[model samples]
Target: MCLKRGRTLLQYAISPAVWLGVWQLASMAVGMDLLLPSPMAVAASLWKLAGTPQFWLSALFTLGRVCQGVLGGVALGSALALLTHFTVWGERIFAPAIRVMRATPVVSFILLVYLWVDRATIPAVVAGLMVLPILWGNLTVGLESVDRQLLELARAYRFGRWKTLRLIYLPSLRTHFASGLLNAFGLAWKSGVAAEVICPPALAIGSRIQQAKVALETPELFAWTLVIVALSLGLEGILRRVVHPREERGQ
Candidate 1:
């Protein structure tokens, strides 16, 4: 059984290995690490980064900003969604604004925000703005999707608004909220870090990445990118476990 499990794991790993091989070959063909680094080089750079206190500090700083932005966005988006539901005029007023935000280029927002705030806070605000529309839109749709018949039944049973919201609206909205969070979290991470790279906060992963780029440290740049991807994936995994534990238990 141990051997079989090991073999299964190896089988699962093969595809990634093959893809990495192709990437390394392409990088070698280009003969410029400045453009594209090999997997081994990135791994080595990552190992070096893992040994540094500064690396940890920078990573933590970025992580805190991302978490703060996500939490703030979720709260504001949920509140806005509820308000829009309560008043048709609110919906009409907010919908076009959300659409405009969604349509605006992220770079434009970053530049605009940079002019107003310092580097450290710009990432958080940019992340929040980027995620707000996604959460609001998805949650609004989720609330709308709640069964009208079930709502009528709740009313017939004399369920208060709060009780109905807790028992009925919440369960129905979970999946939509989950999807929104998953999408927004990744987007927020990328855009937030991009903002940071441009703004160069005192101690941020993006600042380090920007330095790496300026110094032509391709391996370190790739390593930082790998770290970002790892963190994003880790957060997503934790959210999945916490948000859908019942689904796992059922399985």
Candidate 2:
């Protein structure tokens, strides 16, 4: 077991060493920090940024926007899913519209949405738009996947709608709902931030990233990109821990 662990560690270290070697070689070949900043340069800029209050402020504000967008998307998507699941007419009403939403380009929606809403709200709208179809589609499948036998049993036992939903429907749907939320949350954050970058919302990480890009601060740009990646990964890790702790612990 110890031998296996040592081999795994060595293998992991080998990849980074190889990548760093390639990156350094490429930097030397280019001989221009403006084109592609070295890994060390990016790291140094990230370190400097980490010492600033604005870094935390921007990160927190971006997180708040992402959170708001996520909640709005989840709530709206779940409601729509339930509506379509319960009513044939509701399914007919929304099925085509949902398809259109899914097929439409993100940029098109962003541009159209910019007409009335502020830059701050644009991120939320974009996030909601991206997440809506994903959650709705997954949740519709989940609702339909409820066992007929169990539902019939509930009916036989005179279960009320609330009781039936809580006991039979919810438990059965948990996996699908959780999966949808997990998948959509990441996409929402990415699209929301992209929207914010385009819209140039004040105090947002996206705006900071845009500013870095405009100033040709490649290291700062890379640092901001790294921060986004880290935040996304961290949020995903937290969600996994909270929502699927049993499965992870078992593993």
Candidate 3:
């Protein structure tokens, strides 16, 4: 087990090392910071940015918006899933709209939403829109796939609605719920950031990225990009730990 664990760690470390080497080589070949800033230069810019209050504020604001969108989406999606799955009328009314939302481009939503809402709210709204359909789909499938036998057993045992939900439905839907959350969070974070790039809230990572681009600050741009990547990975890792705590510990 120890050897396998060590090998896994080594593999993880080696991939990054290889990629960094390739990136450095590519930057050297380019011979232009504007076109392809070196990793070291980007790292320096990141370090500089880290010292600023604005960097922290931007990260915090963006994180809050993404989280807000994810929570809102989850709540609404769960409600709609329940409605549509249980009622013919609800399905007829809402299913097609959910499908349309799933099919629509994120940019289109951002642009259309931009006209109706405050600039700062666009990222959260877009993020919520991105998450809603995903959650609705996953939960709808979960509802459909639930073991009918267990439900019959619950009925035979005279289980109350709340009791059945707590003992049977919740456990049955755990995997689907966890996966949906993970998928929705990733989409929400990405869409929210993209929305911010398009609409540029006053204090956000995407706004900083936009500013860096407009200023032609390639190293800073790369640095900000690195920040986004790091945050995404870090947050996803945390989410994985939360959703699969037992599996994470076993690993």
lDDT of 2: 0.89
Candidate 3 ranges beyond 4 A from true positions? 1-8
* Candidate 1 segments exceeding 4 Å error: 1-4, 249-251
User: Each model's C-alpha lDDT?
Assistant: 0.91, 0.89, 0.94
- Candidate 2: deviation at residue 58, Å? 0.8
lDDT of 3 by residue, 37-154 (tens): 9999999999999999999999999999998998899999989998898899999999999999999999999999999999999999998998899989988998899899999999
| TM-score of each model, paired residue for residue | 0.94, 0.93, 0.96
Write model 1 residue lDDT over 87-179, tens digit each, in one string: 999889998898899899999999999999877999999999988999999999999899999999999999998999999999999999988
Sliding window of 10 residues with minimal summed lDDT for model 1: 242-251
Give, for candidate 3, the lowest lDDT window spanning 10 residues. Answer: 165-174
> Which parts of model 2 are misplaced by more than 4 Å?
1-14
Clashing pairs in 2: none
